[model samples]
Target: MSHDARVFLREFLRDPARVAAVAPSGRRLSQVLAGAVPRRGVALELGPGTGAVTDHIRHREPRRHLAVEVNPRLARLVARQWPDVEVVCADAAELGPVLDAWGAARVDAVVSSLPWALMPEAQQRTIMTAVQAALTDDGCFTTYAYVHALWMPPARRLPRLLRTAFTHVAVSPVVWANVPPAVVYRARAPRRDVRAD
Candidate 1:
């Protein structure tokens, strides 16, 4: 297994709630998430465990790439591996200040691997609100949901939350190559003046 997979596994074992994936994201899913970004401005990545998606973000050559990981070990590893990347060990909901510290008010793309299925509705709303607020008007937020979990109440409710927050939301075809088969959800930030709060 790759080092990233090993590190991700270690972190997942440490706290499954924090790192909810069964395994590190595969190359295909990473490609899809990274490519979903329409432009190359400040890109914010949430839950970049082991840098699986971070590599692809760098490959896309965004103007500035920032990753926030709740896992301290994973955050350290990402910073060590990608010395230039701004890797912060914090919650995704702190996006606004994190961006401000970097002299950025908006991000063009947000690639997240957060375990939305595992979070409570209130927590999900808080993070989603932060994500919506952090994005630029034309920004896109790309995240995936496990195919098998679609029937779950939280999974079903995810769309409703997104629709309430964004101007458009698109679901990509299932990526069978991923360990547990997943589909990407790409949401366009609302064009109207809106505050997620």
Candidate 2:
């Protein structure tokens, strides 16, 4: 954590209304990334708060990855740490242009850590729509949500909507040894419609 990060984290902790604590464990990251990501293809990541998932992506090299972070401060940190990875400081909803600029016409997968439960329903739909548009026919987009009683409504509904965009949707539990256990939702891109010749 940088000096500035400490200050930001302190302030975040004070309220933490929007901040959900579901820090990715190295083991859990390996599991989800391995299962969801293809061996070699363009990958995209959203809301990489402190490079927890970013580190995993680096460790397991994809063909290339475009990581978009809304927070400029965190974006700088990720760029500095993973200089090889493409880092963009922008909203998740605005990923199309950035991905095109990065030469990612179609991504194979997107591993996200964007606190989805906290976002408004409309915002969630927008971001997921962007994700769907960016992915290849077989691409998968994976994200995690905190395990809590109150967050259930959105949590349950997200997977269903993901089905509309992706061909497959699966959720798995990852019990974090550190703080709170989380469930990772893996959604595969919708299959392309093929016509019989």
Q: What are the runs in model 2 whose C-alpha is more than 4 Å off?
A: 1-8, 14-19, 22-26, 149-151, 176-178, 191-197
In the range 1-197, model 1's lDDT, one tens digit per residue, is 87777877887788988798758888999999998565567888999888889999988778788899988888999999998789989988777688788787778898999888887888788888888887888888999999998888878878888888898999999999999899999999554565444
lDDT per residue as tens, model 2, 1-197? 55545644763575354445523344665457545667666778887767767777766678886789887777898898788878899988787778777877788888887777776777778777778877788778888766763356767667766776777888775546424566777877554452101
Cα distance off (Å), candidate 2, residue 140: 1.4
Quality of model 1 by C-alpha lDDT:
0.84
* Reference-based lDDT, each prediction: 0.84, 0.70
- Per-prediction TM-score, please? 0.94, 0.83
Clashing residue pairs in candidate 2 (N, C-alpha, C atoms within 3 angstroms): none
For candidate 1, the per-residue lDDT at 34 reads: 92
Give me the overall lDDT of model 2.
0.70
**Regions more than 4 Å wrong, model 1:** 191-197
lDDT score at residue 73, model 2, on the 0-100 scale: 70
Model 2 TM-score, all chains together: 0.83
